[model samples]
Target: DDIAEAVISLEIMRDRATAHREDFETLYAAMHGLYSWFLRVCDADGKEYALKQHEQLFETWGATLSGEQSLSPLESAGLTQESVGDVMRALSAASKYNQELKEQKERMSGAALNTCEKVLNPLKFLLSNGATTARDYRVVIEKTLSDTEKALSTQAQRSSLARLPMDELVKIQFRCLNPALAFRELVGENGARSVILTSGTLAPLNSFASELGVDFPIRMEAQHCVDMNTQVWGSIVASGPSKRVLNAGFKSRSDWAFQDELGASLKEWAKVVPHGMLMFFPSFSLMEAIVHRWR
Candidate 1:
């Protein structure tokens, strides 16, 4: 019953996605469907489902490039048989890696990492021009499958438990939370002799540089091109039209009275602000909440 419901939901999403002409939307629907199906099957069979999925993906892509198959877009885009073969090899390595993790209790081996890196050229070619053709979609699907295997490899490597729970494994999100580390990786040794960062938004330069783990021997702040007195008009309003405190802090921003007062203030401003008015909110959810309250 759960699998049937998931299939129905995926069909509905695919229908809606196809209604639009955008390829990314269709791709999103397909990925969502795959994930939904995986969740259900994983719940039923745990680790075996993941291993089987990897093996199936490897076999499917391998078959596509086998024999005298018509490779239209791939050949037209200058992707040689050898480049596509790299992606196939990566998929095979990924399947092997998953099997090893599941059975032999092995982490991501150096050989597996090198094999995964070998597909970078093919993946880049497929992703260079926005995914439009069926060939692009096929390569992308294989790339995503390979990436998921790599993510699972990482999870298995970092985890201390003998086996990671299926639920937790399914929910794993790979993200770079440390900006400093990312910056260091971006500016590797000998990559950049000197990095000059300049942006109007970088007001607190010290904090920004510290966050990036970089040091600038020479730092200069350029003045605004336009005279502030003549061109820009800025004001801080502590209270709204009703003299209600315009506190947009976490707790008070949602207060009915505060929202009402802010709306009233904007209404008055709209009458005199002339051509247009731009309102900025700290976050989209907060803006949505305020708009809902106003309506």
Candidate 2:
């Protein structure tokens, strides 16, 4: 009965994957058609206005493909499911490529702009391909993505996008990091008698167990080496003399006013701090925006 259900699920996944590929191809064609139109039109105010509109629409299409734009809760609920993690990952990846396209559009001119294109190209085979199961496929894809991002970042020409060859391009799909199946897959379906997962601060045993997909894994929180309050130096500066609230969100990231305020706060904070101060952001894009402001 379990095997039969699994088979049915795989069939459903296969159908969905095919549909997604077709949807991507259609979007690519529409965007390409606009580009072609832009090329043929003689210099005119109407043509310029139409081209700008086409660029905006193309960006929207990319956002839709990447899942940065929202869908109904019912539609996106499967985003957490291990079975469809790869699908979500692939869709999420559209955002990265979309951002890349937006950044490069202004730079492409003449022969560069005329380069032949592959719309919604799927060079990497989907896990639905019979070679690998979803369980391990997520891990493999995540590792590969990490390596690819690292290589791209370290390249001398920082602004250039990492262009993968045709063979590896298909592999650039997203993979869910917290798939919640590591324990079961590692221990085997029969279950292991003894397995230990330990950390210095493993509080909230039930949540940890849920994340690991293990039933009631034992938890132990070690005593702190030093008082956290004594060791940590934290300060909150809500506003500077300008009396502007210092906060950051997707909408606020690009606003010069917000970036200026945030940048000023960080610069002041850095001046007082004697040691290294680590900062984190909700996304790489936001982090890059702030960093650019600092530069």
CA RMSD, predictions in order: 20.0, 16.2
Which lDDT tens digits does candidate 2 get at residues 182-207? 44545666778778877766667778
TM-score for each model? 0.38, 0.38
Query: After superposing candidate 1, which stretches have Cα over 4 Å from the reference?
Result: 1-182, 188-198, 204-207, 217-223
lDDT (10s digit) by residue, model 1, range 128-185: 3333222323311111222232233433344332132432333211222336644664
Report the poorest 10 consecutive residues by lDDT, candidate 2.
Answer: 56-65
Leading candidate by lDDT: 1
The alpha-carbon lDDT assigned to residue 254 of candidate 2 equals 63
Candidate 1 accuracy as lDDT: 0.47
Q: Rate the local accuracy (lDDT) of all candidates.
A: 0.47, 0.39
